[model samples]
Target: MVDRLEQSKALASQARLSVLGWLADPQAHFAHQVTGPPAEIGVCVTLLAARLEMAQPTVSRHLEVLRRAGFVTVRRIGKWAYFQRNEAALADYKAWINDHL
Candidate 1:
């Protein structure tokens, strides 16, 4: 019983942390259309920086946080780097939390 509780506690903490990480960078961590509706893919670093009125390096640091947490993925095209949510991993994590908690 103790072990099970401990495991659940750990998982709950991790799930909470992951959600925080995913939202850490609303612009850099997500992609959507500038107007009208949101896009299927996330935004690139340059675009995110423009939207946030921040520097590329600053946005980069936030992206690193999300990437390390397994909440986002990065892709490079030329000199630009794009980020997208790892939907599968996030979905699985949410499912686990919903089941255990």
Candidate 2:
């Protein structure tokens, strides 16, 4: 209960919300990768950092927050980390929001 409230509060940041929006439509928000499309796996941290116009470390910290909030999921392909939205988690979050507030 209290923990859920705390988790919800953690996602209140503008940066985290923006990250979720980009992830919502990876193909639309992100560009195609040399290896493949962002939709195939997930958007790479480098691309996300570039799009956000923030330092890699800063973007990474935002991603970490989203990941902890269950709004994003991470996959590592070699040295790079890719991120995708967790639709189920988002749906759950939405429901929680509706119920709580």
Candidate 3:
């Protein structure tokens, strides 16, 4: 069904930009962060960049991509920008795609 295909495509889009991928690969992308959550903690851009050994601007670009794809939500806390998994949105997207596709 066209609808099903659309649903799958939407989720695929999200997965392509998942913050989960970064969280899943903490050693690779989470090492450089100064003070960040563990695997149990949500990944933040600054921490992620530190872990990834990348520049803040670069990490921000990646985070922006994920945020746009509906994979993560960014909230500014004081002077820090915290990124969290959009679990509810992701779950809803998965369920819709599963039901339709």
Strongest candidate by TM-score: 2
**Superposed Cα RMSD, model 2:** 1.9
Write model 1 residue lDDT over 1-101, tens digit each, in one string: 12333333433444334434544554444535353112334456666666566788876776676666565677765666667767675676677669978
lDDT of 3 at 64: 71
Count of clashes, each model: 2, 0, 6
Q: Which sections of candidate 3 miss by over 4 Å?
A: 1-18, 22-42
**Which of the predicted structures, 2 or 3, would earn the higher TM-score when compared with the native?**
2
- Per-residue CA lDDT of model 2 for 9-90, tens digit only, reads 6687887788788888888887666655788789999888998889999999888877877778999989989999989888
Instruction: Go through the candidates in order and give each one's C-alpha lDDT.
Output: 0.56, 0.82, 0.61
**Runs off by more than 4 Å, candidate 1:** 1-42
* lDDT of each residue in 34-71, candidate 3, tens digit only: 55644444556666666566788977876776666565
Clashing pairs in 2: none
TM-score of each: 0.55, 0.89, 0.56
In Å, residue 86's CA in model 3 sits off its true spot by 0.8
